[model samples]
Target: MNRRHLRWTVPAVTVFVASVVAIVLFTQVGGSAACAAGGSASYYSAGRNGMCNLGTPAEGLYAAVGRAEYAGGKACGTYLDVTGPNGTVRVQVVDLCPSCPAGKIDLGKGAFARIGALSAGIIPVTYGTTRDPQVGPLQVKLTGGTAYSALTAVLNNHGNPLSTVELQTPSGFAPMRQGEDNTWTAPSGAVTSPVTLRIADMYGHQATVAGLTLGPKDFQPTGTVLYGGPSPSPSDSPSPSTVESSAPSPAPVASAGPSSLPPAPKC
Candidate 1:
């Protein structure tokens, strides 16, 4: 009696393993965390022209979070929707309120007007991250330094709070350091003209801005918007992907003069 040879297909097994790996990676980096907290809300004008040296505050759409929610610079670009007795308003995190108690937020004049009267001074409010809010393209402002030297940058209009920032240099990608006031500084060797930037947020989403000509006052706009959705579980969604194309245009040079606005009020 002859026994038939048993055969196992290796190609099918290989394909199955690859698919599993891809799915695992995607689940690891595809979603954002949902943040909600209740606290006292107050209004301030200090960030009226924008905080953290990013730019002028978007009237009625900006806020300065306290230590509890600010989480250092991690919460810099995150948006929060605040609800009070009067109504609810959405505001971007532009600055920090050093003295603000936990769960407290300081809204700009415009933002306060939307939710409550400025005369209220302070009011009880509940705030949370906006779910999948529509945002504009990423704006990268070269705040300090010049071409051919160490440089500082501020990224605005990002849908989620950035967790890391990297610059594409002639040699390769270089990591940047986060500084006070929502600023990021490039490493020494990475400071060069006509650079590209790769920015990633806490939600595992990323975008690239190319063709940036480094200068004391240069700015670059990536013609793509970022959309960050609600929190993701380990088994949900796909891996993080780049949101936009690499459109590089000259941005207005930042002024080197001190801020003309008066000091922001403390809580």
Candidate 2:
């Protein structure tokens, strides 16, 4: 009887799991025939500068898409019309979200607030591109390079996404490399003064901004029309095919003449 054994019992703990549900919304903008997709939208504060490097975060009209839609810089500078429970807002694809799943758009804080409440955190949205949006005049900005050589620029307010950019040099038309953040870099070569730029969109619509004198600063009020549609009237807008001649030349400015770079070695 002297040997008494003592035993202790522990109570079992309960575990709980939280379920997350995401709703998908879909809608077409401007009565366009383009296909619309349902997706989830969230907001982020990633700073004013984005992958496109065109608009700022303060503008509240920029968005970032998933890697699939980003296509590197291919999706940059493109516009998406997103509609939420509150209203519809058009936003530009300026950045990229590597972790965002397909069919999801991460919008800037300002842009998200326009469509839904900040407290919502995440919301359902329907998004698609609008055909020939009235984006007003084309504004071109020189982001890198000097008037002397190796210029990089970003074309804005063009409504449609640019597919290619060619610079008219003394030698010939040289294609520019579309870089991340909506910047187009000039090929390794001498780009003569009085730069002429020919920009084309995915729809084959082209716009030529002639007579640009590259300087170490920005250029605005370019007075270039965003060319789109078939057979624009001669007085109204120049046709994409014949804009080279019809478009007016930019004002003359001093340049670093005859600057050249070593040719890029063949891979």
Candidate 3:
């Protein structure tokens, strides 16, 4: 995956507005609309709200999405569009102040990242929801024995039902069998016991299920699985990530004061 790194630092300027009750903080990840597609994940905040550690949430976890970039590389107002509990939100880099480091976005108190489990600073995030952003009615289940649990999902995209569906486990690939109720199931038995899994739309869209402890006892539904199923593995068991989550890794977010600068500059 080609990852682009960019950061915007907005200077705190107190501008008095007649009708405005409060002065709001604004930060923009400097870039053209065309360039907003894919940049390295980072954090942005408005005021001196709360302090967050770096890379607490793993790379493939979920983060709440808030505030949209309307146009002209600026926001009309600070609007937060938080999805479900562990849903994916695509936020644009409007202005950049409260400048945390990479893999972090400081949205102040009203807006936050790690909404669910708060063990780490950062979490993994997908681009969109498991199903369509407007319409999502997908369900995944894990059954069968503990050694090779079967993961299944029913995908309904818009009105068109996809004929062939595929499910992914951490170890390898399995074809999903479409059921009468517009659902699909992956083949049973695999190398690993429980595996991390994901499903794909006809358009090659992928979604993830986080922290699916697929052992004998832990084989049950936990959080919402958007487009993908669950795949549990012993070695690669998903854990919370800080920028330092990967070990021997430099801190993605810098400490405050003199070193509080982004590794990458504004695009």
lDDT value for candidate 2? 0.56
RMSD of 1: 22.3
Which stretch of 10 consecutive residues in model 1 shows the poorest summed lDDT?
21-30
For this target, which candidate reaches the highest TM-score against the unseen true structure? 2
Predictions in order: lDDT:
0.56, 0.56, 0.29
lDDT tens readout by residue for model 2, 166-241: 8887777789888656678887655555778988765546788886765535435467765533222213121122
Clashing pairs in 2: 51-181, 52-181
List TM-score per model, in order: 0.67, 0.68, 0.25
Stretches of candidate 1 above 4 Å error?
1-37, 47-50, 143-149, 216-218, 228-267
Displacement of the residue 239 alpha carbon in candidate 3, Å:
36
Q: What lDDT score is found at residue 166 in candidate 2?
A: 87
Best-performing candidate as measured by lDDT = 2
Order the candidates by TM-score, highest first.
Answer: 2, 1, 3
